[model samples]
Target: MGEIMGNFRRAINNTSLSRFRFYFQAASFLLLIYGGYLALNLGDQLPTFACIFSEPRGGSCYLFGLQHQMTTPWTSYLSGRGIGLLVGFLTFIAFFIVFNKAWCGFACPLGTIQDWLTALRARFKIRYANYAEPTFQRLKKIKYILLALLILIPMAIGNSFFGLPKLNHDFGVPFCMICPGRTILPLFSGDFSQLALDLSSKSKMILTALGLMVTGIFLSGSFIKKRFFCLFCPMSAFHYIFANAALLRLSKDAGKCSRCGNCYRACDVGIRAIADDLQHKNIVKDDCMLCGKCVEMCPEEGCLQVKFLGLPIYQSTAEGFFKRMQGRNNAK
Candidate 1:
């Protein structure tokens, strides 16, 4: 049994992470997109985009619930309604703590779609685009701004703020009003109603137009830039707020790293901290999806790792690195 276990570990360590992730993402994509046919409802507080717009979805995004919860009357906090909000928040935290940002990297239907586009681009021999350092630094903050708006706008709709008039009800769920996921994810399940422009109200018309425009950008941008939408995802920002409390984590052993730049190149979201941060042991940055790509690509033994509850689940190994390289060479 001991020998068998060792061999199994060796096999996993040497396998192609990209190939493994492709199959995993495919399964997750199906489960999230079509699992409702099996009556598999994970719930409405999932950290990832199990879009409600996609009928019979396995789950719903937490943002959808949060935005609505924020619309409750300010005085309701003293009533039983407040308990429901607390329970909902606790539930979201429970879900988020288990997998951490792996929800974004592994299970998000939208993220999987972006990955498929990236693969398609690769197949066509097209070069991918990258943000300039200055631009990346600036753009990454957009998610936080979006997160702030999603929270404050809903509150404003419920009650006046700073002596200002209450926002129009048509601005309901402001973030969702413009989210591209509502426009795109439904198409997988044969629903195209989101494609139409809403003329019922002026606000709806403007929101629908913006939603359509974002959907166009989502499709085109994701094709050219890996995980393009992730840079500005409010959900990503939300996850980062509680990242330190998650059980699953990415950590680095700076002492073991030779800094050959392999891990940085492997990062889909272009997180520079994974490669350059030598001072901190915990390396899961806000933009990191906990995708495990950095660990898989590192050539230095024990340099990078994915840990669950402080125990290493997967880590870089020189032997594994060499074996993977050999396998790639054989394939060619």
Candidate 2:
């Protein structure tokens, strides 16, 4: 028991954990640049699946290709607008269960933008207020309300009580109009052409607000900590609902935990996994973006790992089998 306890203590004091956090942050930035480039060049649109839009004849609008086809079918089905919404809901559920918010951390074009802005803000030594506390938690709900409005208002108007077939027609692609990801693509491509007719004054205001929000997030992350915009993203609301059952989880061994709070401080999501009760050893909180920073920062050996399907999937350090065998023999 004494030997086992000593090894556990040694693991907790390990220093490589901090280096891993640096690497994870670097990788996320590289992915953002690549995704942003794809969004800008219109390379994200595949030619084979272009018939799903109202204006299929006008070459291939970036909105027509990805966001419209993917999110709409799901949103429509969820809103009871069509049978396809069921498919969308199921697919989203599957993704949530398997990988949690991996999409937001890695693949989301908008997330990439926010991350880049945060990086820039950090480099320039800017400052913004930290909105990560309980007071700002309610602000996170705005996305869900917006999502509800996006789906509900269209369904109500499309039912024809308002005599608005044109409104219904527009509803098929409404999310694209306000999507920050789609908007940023046009800005990067050096084409203000799409901005002239498509964006309304309200949308322009929203865009302006989003720009300011990005700036604030950047400044906050630079002066405060990384991943500031994650607090208010609607996509995260969806992820929050499904995170509890996610197949991949960050696990911590309580016996090895030294209670130094370094992992909590390193975590941008504010999950204090080390301080939590032992029964729920998994930090399966909705706020966790699965960036693996906590796992990387954990000083305890075998105390922190990324687990999948009830088995350990990733470990920061590797010890030879002979060493493990020797340790086990000595323990006996």
Candidate 3:
């Protein structure tokens, strides 16, 4: 078993998995949007933000997006129908633990789109922006705030419907109302209907405008910054709250580390805690999407590793780093 594991780690570390991860992202993007029609043949859709749409979503139980998964199930508390909420919540947990934040890294259509934008910027040789340490630290709090609002607004709105059926038409799923993913992901399917302004009510108009504005910022910001929206993604906050349950993790070898800045520079989210915190061995941070960019870039043998169920699948090595760089230069 030890020999087999050692060989697996060596095989993984020799080649950059991020390059192959793109294949998974592209395939998942296709599957999420069109898999049901394309004969995936699953009885129910795997739960995801985009799968909660009305007619077009592929998921088994289509609620009002991920927000519905968060709210409607809890509504049983106020009303008498707790079963849907309880079942849906369990489904969410089941899908969540399989890979945890790896969803953000590998499968999320929004995150994939942002990565494509980063690639486009790189192709043009345009410099990407990185937040300074202090600014980045402060920005980390935004996701938590968004997470709170997403849950609170839905709970309030779900309850209000029982008490006052005519509350804000757009109140039930407040985060989805303004989530850029709602307006952005459907465009690939040749659906622009989501972009239409909701002028039904004064509340709807406000909600529509807010969603558009956030989408606009998302477009421009993602072009200039890597995973720009992820800095404030409520979904990311949700994942980290249950991160401990994930079997896969990023582990650090403090003694093997050399304080090299390459890992920090390579990180898309600008998480500096990877370098500064030598006190802890398991170095998963809340801001970390578990993308493994640091492990790919680090030039220290076994200094950083991608561990699956407490076993190493990949690790950093100086020789491997230089060999890949040299290969790239020669190809150029």
Candidate 4:
């Protein structure tokens, strides 16, 4: 049994994790983005960007449902509507805790699109840019602010909190108003209608304008920088709140890590902590997508691992690293 297990581990480690990820992501992107055509409906409580605006989306993102539910009248809190909202939130949490933020790394259509742009840039021999550590520290806080606003704005629209007047209904789904997914994903289904600016109200006009601008930036920036939009994604902030109790986890063996900097280089979002932090056993940071790139890149045996309920599914190993390198060299 021990020898068989060892052979299985060697087989897995010898395979190209990057190639496996690319195919897995491609399959997931298809199911989420185009599965509705086949009558697939996962639910409305998914943690990732399965944009409802996309006509063929198999599932809907939780943030959109959360914003819609938040617009419920204040008096409904003691009623069945409140119970329904609670159920919805719990459902979202259930889906989220299973994979933590792997939804963002593995299933988000927007993230996949950004990665495709990065690939296109690489194909053209263009260099990708990284944010300076100081800039990254500052920018990472934006997601939380967006998450706060996403919750508060919708509640304000329904109830007069603290003598504040009810906001205009034109501000419906405020985050969705500016989310690039609303504009980008629909294009996959041959729908360019989201690009049309709403002239009906000042709030809507401004929101649509901002949405278009952000979409433009999302396309151009993602080409030059890896996972650009992920830095400011409110969903990422939401995921991190329940991350510690998640079933899937990224763990580091500080004793095994040599701080060789390879993991840092392979990271799509440029999480320096993965390479630098030495104290934390649970190394899943706020920006980490649990994409397993660090583990794939690490040269040390048992340095980094993807664990499910405390059992390691994959881990770094020297033999695996050399095998992967040899495969790449032979391909070249």
lDDT (tens digit, per residue) of candidate 4 on 266-319? 999999999999999999989999889888889998899989999888889888
Please give the clash total of every predicted structure, in order: 0, 5, 3, 0
List candidate 4 stretches off by more than 4 Å: none
Provide the lowest-lDDT 10-residue window in model 3.
54-63
Alpha-carbon lDDT, every model:
0.89, 0.51, 0.76, 0.91
Give a tens-digit lDDT track for model 2, residues 94-206: 64577766655654444555556655775677753455556556665675775555555455443543565423344544544454434344444454443444444654555
* Model 3 agreement with the true structure over 111-203: per-residue lDDT tens digits: 889999999999899999888889998998999998888776666654554565434436777777788877877786678888999998888
Q: Is candidate 3 or candidate 4 better by TM-score?
A: 4
Candidate 4 matches the true fold with a TM-score of 0.98
The candidate, 1 or 4, that scores higher on TM-score is 4
- Candidate no. 3 TM-score: 0.89
Query: Candidate 1, residues 1-332: lDDT per residue as tens digits?
Result: 99998788777777777788889999988888888999998898899988888887888898988998888779997799899888889999999999999999998888999999998999899999999878999999999999999999889988999999998877768888788889988898899999999999998999899999988999999999999999999999999999999999989999987878899998999998888889999888899888888888899978998889998778888888888778879987
How far off is residue 125 in model 2, in Å? 5.1
RMSD of 1: 1.2
